[model samples]
Target: MRNIYLIISREYLERVRKKSFIIVTLLMPILMIAMMVAPSLMMLYSKSEQKQVVVIDRSGVVADNLYESAEATFIREDGMSKSEACNIYNEESGIFGILYIGEVVDARDSVQLITNSSSSMLLEESISSQIEAIVEREKLKEYNIENLDEILAKIETNIELATFVNNGATEDDGEMESTSTGVSYILGIVLGMLLYMIIILYGQMVLTSVVEEKASRVIDVMVTSCTPFQLMMGKIIGIAAVALTQIAIWALLVLSASKFVMPMLFTPDIASTSGALLDGALGTVTDTGYIATLFAYLALFILGGFLLYASLYAASGSAVDSIQDSQQYNTVIMLPIILSMIIMMTVFNDPNSPIAFWCSMIPFTSPIVMIARIPFGIPTWEIVTSLVILYLTFIAMTYLAAKIFRVGIFMHGKRTSWRELWLWLKE
Candidate 1:
């Protein structure tokens, strides 16, 4: 236990104190903040530079509501033909764009947008959609029905129902709970990306570390002092602690950045209409108490998940003599993770469905699947059961990894097969 602790401490400090660690830990938040803010700022700037399009309405019907719905000026040239409208549109200099509406509206199903600037794609699409909406509304009005606003409002209904056994209501009403859910969603995505990054990054680090030790003949001396079992265990645990410490620092940086950065990127209108996208990204926020509980569970999940996989990765690193050899073995460990991420991507919508339930229960996939579902409020029993299964699986995986590590680390200039692995496991 003391040796493991020493190993863990050494590994953690060695990694966290590195220049690469400091640079990445600091730069990730700044990059993420920039990514979040840049798009919104671009959109706002584009909105300010609104283009003035001239709509040359040759259709008497579409001209009926062209002025009411469009940001562009409507020129109703009823007497003029398509050729005349085209002539006028081509000659216009100050016009930002020209929309030529044809007379045979059924034949000319297309809306031609002639724009000089390439940056007006969004504005052009908006104008086209508005024209379509106006034309539809005018056609409806021709049938002697009024209350278009009410009809449109009804069409735009997006009510989400929360399912329950009894009279239980949705927990989204509370600001903190809503905030926490938002937080959970963000954290869930972050967790997935973090898991992917850590697994690949640290897994490669372990492989290179092993190769370096082997190349320097350091492993031979180290194996003489400690059993291969102890050596491998120490290495795996040590590297895992390093990963955890790095992730912890990143979490802190992300939290601090979010406090300032979220408000700047997400407007109140976007937050409200988009329904707490940033909040969901961050994860559940049930006051300070629930936040504490949620974060505690989250930390545990991350630690357990990381350690479980890291052991396999370490074992994989030890199994092969060369980096190229490790790639084939690494796939056996990585395929499940990739599949789990796919499940997580699709699990957000109807997370409590049968697919989600089973996927989250499976130890190989649960960590990602369960985290994705947490924002939508997973059952307590499901979480508990999944954690238990994961813990058990972790024990089994680590034990198998330790066995493989014990044998593989000592063997050199040799390739291993499943039969050999099985024999080693039995031994």
Candidate 2:
């Protein structure tokens, strides 16, 4: 126990003192904050320069109704052939494009828009809608409807649906307000991605540290003072401390930026333009209880998931002499993580589905899949069961990995195989 404590202290201090660790810990939060803010900033600064488009209307019915906006200016052409217009108009002369409206036999296929480059879909849609409105008005006039615009306005409907959750109780007021479906899906995806990245990033760091020590024969010198299992545990726990520290710093940075910086940067106009993206990203801060629960689950799963995979990674490092040789074995560890990420889409679509439930229950995938489900609200029993299974699996895998690590550390000048690993484990 004393030897393990020494090892843990050494490993933890060695990594946290490194330049790379400090750089990554500070840089990551800045990058995350930038990702959240940059889009809104771009939208705030974005100016839509008005485009000049020439309109040649053969039908003469739609021209009077075609209006201009800040995005585009409409220039009507009379007695100009398409060939003549194309020959004279230069993109350098500030003519964005030309819209040639032929006889409207079918509005969908008859309208042709020619541009110097590819036309904007938004511009095309706007033009098409205006023409359609004109046609509708003409048809209504033919029917002798005196108040066509007023009747159309009266018929238009914009419905806003309010969402609520019903808490099953005998009380009169059982319904509580719930988040939108989009908000829920976004939360799940973001949390799932966070889990996946942390595990992969720090887990790979553990694997690399083991490989470096083995390649340098540092393990041989260290083993004189401690057992293989003690060394492995020490390394895993120490690196976990580093991960937690980095995470905490990132959390503080994000909180500070969202609370102080974002307000100064995001005006009402910018927030309106960004719509729900900025809202959803910052919404978690308002719900302190939810945030607490989220971090709790994150902490639990990250520790279990990291320890489980870190053990295998340490064993993989011990079995091999070089980083190049670790590839074949690394695939074995990575495949399950990849599968979990792919299946996360299913969780987003239906969190209560059997696939999501089983995936969350499975130790290999539970770290990611379970975190994905937690944001929307998961049962207490399920969270407990998943955590229990994950930690138990970690313990078992650590023991198995230790068996391999004990023998593999002394191996040299030979390639390892599954048969050899099995022999090591059994012994």
Candidate 3:
């Protein structure tokens, strides 16, 4: 027990103190912040650059009604022909394109946009929408509808939807749980991605650590002091501690940035929209109970999922003499994780489907799938059952992997096979 504790301490301190760990731990949150901020900045820049478009309206009825905005200005052709306008427009630096509203028997098919460079879809859509609006207005006037604007205004409606869940209660006896579909979707995806990345990243780290030790013959000396299972457990636990620490730091940095820095960085409209997006992604930020439940599930799945994969990774590392040789074995471990990610997209669309339910219960996939379903409120029995199955699978896998690790650590200069692994397990 003391030896295992000592090994765990050694592994934990060694990794956390490394330059690579320090650099990555600091850099990841900055990268996440950059990812969030860059798109909004690009959008502002794109909107700021005004585009000049020449309108050559052969159909005179549409020219007077063409809309102009800050992003684009429509220049009406006076007496110049289409070819003359194209030539003059091509010479201008800021001009985006030319819109030719040809004789419109059908507005959709007849309107054409010509540009010297690639055409902008936004510009094309705006022009088409304006022309369609004008055509509709003219048809209404021909029909002698005097209050067309008022009628249209009265008919245009915006709908808001509210969702609620019954919390273990009948309609007469229990309170309703208010929720948002957008919030659940964003949370599920975000949590699912986090699980996928953490498992892949740290699981590989465990594998590499074992391979490095075995390659250097450090495991040969360590085996004289402790059993292979102890060494494996120590390594898994130590690296898990490192993962948790890094996650905590990242969460803190993200929280701080969202609360303090985002307002200063973005305009009021952008900031408000961003805030709404974040709230939708995370649920109500002020709801302590919900937030606590989320973190608990996250911790449970991350730990279970990491241990399950880490055991196999450790076994694979023990079997290989070099990183290159590890590739074939690594592929075996990676396939399920990749498959789970692919299936996650389907889960996002219908969390209550049978496929989602079974996937969440399956040990190999439950860690990601179950975490995704939790934000939307899965059954309590399902969560408990999934956790039990995952932990039991983790134990079985660790035991099987220990059999391989026990023999494979001393192996060298030869490739391992499935038959040999089975023999080791039996022995």
C-alpha RMSD between model 3 and the true structure: 4.3
lDDT of each: 0.66, 0.79, 0.80
Tens digit of per-residue lDDT, candidate 3, span 102-137: 777255657777787776667667777777778887
Q: By TM-score, highest first, what's the ranking? A: 2, 3, 1
Better of 1 and 2 by TM-score: 2
Residue 338, candidate 1: alpha-carbon lDDT: 94
lDDT per residue as tens, model 2, 148-194: 78998899786555444455633356434334455556557776887
Q: Write the per-residue lDDT of candidate 1 for residues 189-290, one digit (tens) a residue.
A: 665666667666876776677766765668888777667767666777777777667656655655555565555555666556543333343222213344
Q: For candidate 2, what is the lDDT?
A: 0.79
> Clashing residue pairs, candidate 2?
none
Give candidate 2's error at residue 233 in angstroms: 1.0
Error of 1 at 142 (Å): 4.4
For residue 248, model 2's alpha carbon misses the true position, in angstroms, by 1.2
> Largest TM-score belongs to which candidate?
2
